[model samples]
Target: MNKKIHLKVNTDLNATGEVLSWFEQINQPPLSDKKIWWQCQTLLIEGFANIVEHAHKNLPLETPIELEVLRLNEYIEIRIWSFGQAFDLQQQLQTKPELTDNFQERGRGLKIMDSIAEELNYLPIDAHRHCLFLKIKY
Candidate 1:
């Protein structure tokens, strides 16, 4: 079975709840498998929080953040669009820069995300916008 969900939300922390609700709508194994479900949810929350805290930090609060989730036969794909300056994701991983989310210790969130996601990528969509992709097997 294949299913997809798309949402466009303001760059506000409040939208995180809505995003989780959106994920629950998928009704797939990712929702039933406790380990996979938790991984997916954690990644979604962390991704959104990262965008709001780092990506869209300087942008207007009203700026839109787009999320597209696709559940395929093998894996689920999540794409997050943020209007932020692009950065070297690979470089950051290699350099081990400090990362903290909502009072969490540095780099903890990122470590979880990196370990959970089967694939993770960030690339520029334009001069000031970028897209983050996270794929997880269900």
Candidate 2:
């Protein structure tokens, strides 16, 4: 496994910058293919946004979200822990969205994450503890 990088941020826009910096800090240089880089950026941004907007729904104003990245064998694992209302990704998946109806603007975040990451998991320990795991091949 390569060196792992971790970052934690408050429920604010600043988290976006932190995630972007992580991509640059990787040992490998940026990919020559803009498409791959763009997809990576999108996944990171959406993943962070989901944590802030969805997982941390009842987070205290003073507490920040905790995020950790683990570089494991053949994959990068991103774990986001939150001290807010817990939720289940499986529930979200069960309620399949209606693609033809474009009125509601919900449930898209997880969908996007599913697209980029090879695996995605949402676990809830209790009403106030939640964790999201996203894994992508490196």
RMSD of each: 3.0, 2.8
Model 2: per-residue Cα lDDT at residue 53 = 75
- Give candidate 1 regions above 4 Å deviation: 29-32, 97-107
Q: For residue 88, give model 2's deviation from the true position in Å.
A: 1.6
Candidate 2 — what's its lDDT? 0.69
Which number leads on lDDT? Answer: 1
Cα deviation in Å at residue 85, candidate 2? 1.5
> Which residue pairs collide, candidate 1?
none
Query: What tens-digit string does per-residue lDDT give for candidate 2 at 1-138?
Result: 465777777787566887788656653544456665566666677777887777665665556767777655566677777777666677875575644443567667777777688888877757667778878775
TM per candidate: 0.88, 0.77
Which ranges in model 2 have alpha carbons more than 4 Å from their true place? 27-34, 96-106, 125-127
Q: In candidate 2, where is summed lDDT lowest over 10 consecutive residues?
A: 23-32
| Least well predicted 10-residue stretch by lDDT in candidate 1 | 97-106
Question: In model 2, what are the clashing residue pairs, if there are any?
Answer: none
Question: What is the overall TM-score of model 1 with all chains considered together?
Answer: 0.88
